[model samples]
Target: MLILWICFLRGARPILFIDGCHLSSPYKGTLLAASTCDANNDLFPIAYAIVSAENNENWIWFLSNLKELTGSISVTLISDRHPSIIAAVEQVYDRDRHAYCYRHVKENFCVETKKLQRGIRGEVKEDAKKLLDAVCYTHFGTEFTKAVEQLRAFSPELANWLETKGDINKWAKSQFPHRRWDLITTNVAESFNSWIRKERTHSICALITEHRDKLANLLYIAKLEMTKWNNEVGPKIDKILMEHVARSEFLKAVRYGDHNVMVRGSNVDVCVNLLRKECTYLEWQMTGIPCPHACAAIKLLHSNIYTYVEECYLKSSQEKIYASSMIPIETHDMPDVNNLTLTDWENNIFLMPPTTTRSLGRLCKKRRESQFQDVHVYKCSRCDQSGHNRSKCRNPNPEKI
Candidate 1:
C-alpha cells in the first residue's frame, strides 16, 4: 500500500481506473482493484483488496481505504456502471470526477437493441450499432448529434432507449470532460486483473504477496527502460505526435489572431488555438496530444510541438513514477520459531482462513460471450479474398465473372 501511494503521487496523471474481479479461491472473494496508465500507457496497479463479496458495503470499504491512500488529490475515475461502485465513489470521493467505460455501455446498448430488434427488420440493428460506435468516438458535439440522429432514423425506439439509460455526456467522447483525456474504457484495470489471474486463486495473504512481487519487478524494469528514453515525451506520446505531424502535411494553416490559426482540411476547416492548447475538432483537448489541426498550427509557429503535450506523457514524470524501488522481504532474517507449540501458535500468531460457501456449479474460468459476439465476415469483390473488402483489396487485377 505504501508503494502504491508512492507510485501514484509520483505520476503526473490524476486519473484512476477502478474495477472488481471475482477471485477463484476457495474463499471466493472479490478483488477490488484501482489502477492507472503510466507514461507508456501500460497498466500501473495502485491499490487492491480482497473482500467476501462485491456490494455497497465492501465497495465503500475499499474506496475509503483508497481515499486515505490518495489523499485529497483531484482524480478522474473510470469504471463500469456498477451500482455499488457508483454509490461508493459518490460517498467517498464526491468532488472527484467519474466516467463510465464505453465498452460496458456499448454491451448494455447491444442488449437493449436486441430487445428492440424483435420489432425492427434486418440491418436496422446493425446500422444502429454502427451509429452508436460513431457516437462513442466522435470528438465534436455536431458529429455526435449527427450520429445520434442517424441512429434515430434507423430506430427511434432504440435511440430513445439509449436516452433513458442516462446522459450522453457520460459515455460520449465529445461530451466527456477533457481531464479524462482519451480513456473511455477501464482496460487498464482489466489488463491488471488478467495479469494477476493466476494469483487470484491463492489465499488472501499469498495473493497480496504475489501482487507486491509482480509490481516490484514491473517497476524495476520500467525504471531501467525509462533511463534509455531520449525523447522529451514518452515513446507512446512521441509516436502519436509523429503520426499527427504526418497528417498535418495535408492540412493548410492560416494565421489568425495571436496564438490562433485556421487549419483547412480537405473537407473542413478547424480553428486551432495554441494559447489554449485546443482545436475546434476537440481531438487535441480530448487526447492531451496535438491533433492534425493543432499540429499544422504548431508547424506554422515553428515551435517545439511536444511542449503542447500533457506533462503526464513526459519522460521526466515517467522517471519519477518508477524512482522508488520495492524492497523484498527477506525470510532468512526471521528468528526460528519452530519450537512453539501448535496450540500456542494458533492462539497467538496464526490467523484463521476466511469462511466461504462453495458455489453450486463447477468452477469455471471462461467468461460467457455477450450478445455482440456475432462474427461478421468480409470478402473482397475484386479478388475473392476472405479477409478484405474490394476497396482495400491488394490484388491489382481480378477475374471477370
Candidate 2:
C-alpha cells in the first residue's frame, strides 16, 4: 500500500495511504502491522513496530519505536482502537501533536460497547451517541467528558477503568480542535483494503511482489501526467519564491535594540529591546509567538538565529504565508474523499513484510533474561495460590482460616 501511495502521489497529487492488517507468519503468530508512503513515490515499509493485539507488553514496546519514528516531525497517526495502539500513542504523543482517526475512535467505541457494555449499554446509549457526534477535536473533550460522567452513573467500574489508564484531562485537551471529521475515522485504509481484495488472492509472496510492481507502474504514470502541470506551476512557484526572499531579507534588516533583529539566544547587553513591550503582551496572553523584541533578542544573542524564528515566534506558520490570493492555496483545503479519485486500481500495490530480529515484546524479555533474573513467580498471601501475588489475593486471611 505504501508503494502504491507513493506512486499515486508522484503524479503531482501527493497522497499517503495508511492501513493495518492481520497476517500470519511462518514462525510467529498473527501480527498487526502498519505501513506509509510519501509524495516522492518513496515507499517506507513497516515504518513502525509490529505488535500483537493480545499482549500488554506490546503497547510499551510499540511506544519505544513510535518515539523513534515521530522524532520532531509533525506527524499524525490513524489506527483502529487496539488498546496497544491507543496506549502507545498516548505514551509517545501526549502533546497532541498528532491527529487521530475519528473513524477508528467511533468504531472502537461502538465495538467495545456492543461486546462489553452488556450491563450498562442501555443506560449509556445516549452518552455514546453524543461522543460519536463529537468526533472533531473542538468538541471531543466536552462530549467525551459528559458521556463518561453519564457512564460513571451507570458503571463506575468502566469509568474508573478509563481514568486509571491515563490522565483523562490531559488526553482531552490534546485531542480538541480536530482538523476534520473524516480524519477521525479508519476509511483511508479501507480504500486500500478493497483494492487489495480485488487485486490479489494468491500466495503471500505473489501478493507482496505483484502489488509492489503495480504501484511502481502507477507512480510512473502519475509522474507522466504531472509533468505538464509541474511545468506550469514551476515558473509561478519561482516567482513566489523570489518575492518571499525579498520579504525575508527585509525582515532580517529590520533592527531591534543595538543588534540586528534575530530569532535566537543573546545576552541582554548585546541586544536592544526593540519590541520588549510586544513580547510582554504575548507572554501575558499565553500566546507562543515571539514579540518583536524577542525577534530582536534573537539577532543579538546567536550567530545563527533565523533557524528558530518559525518555531519560537510564529504560533501558527499558517499565518506567515500572507496574501489574500495565497490564503486559499495555502490552506489546500481539499474537498471530501468521495470527491477524490482512488484513481488507478490496477496500479495499487502492497509492501514486503518487514524483517525483525525479534518480536516487539522480546526487548523486555531479553532485557530480563540478560539481567539473569529469576522467573517472576507469584504467591498469594491469603490463598497461598501460585498464580497470584499478595496484592492480588482475593481470599480471606490465611491465618484466620
| lDDT tens readout by residue for model 2, 211-234 | 555545544553453344332232
Candidate 1 structure lDDT:
0.83
Which residue segments of model 1 deviate by more than 4 Å? 119-124, 333-348, 358-365, 370-401
lDDT of each: 0.83, 0.41
TM per candidate comes to 0.86, 0.37
Give the per-residue lDDT of model 1 (tens digit) for 303-344. 999889888888877888887888888767543468677787
Count of clashes, each model? 0, 20
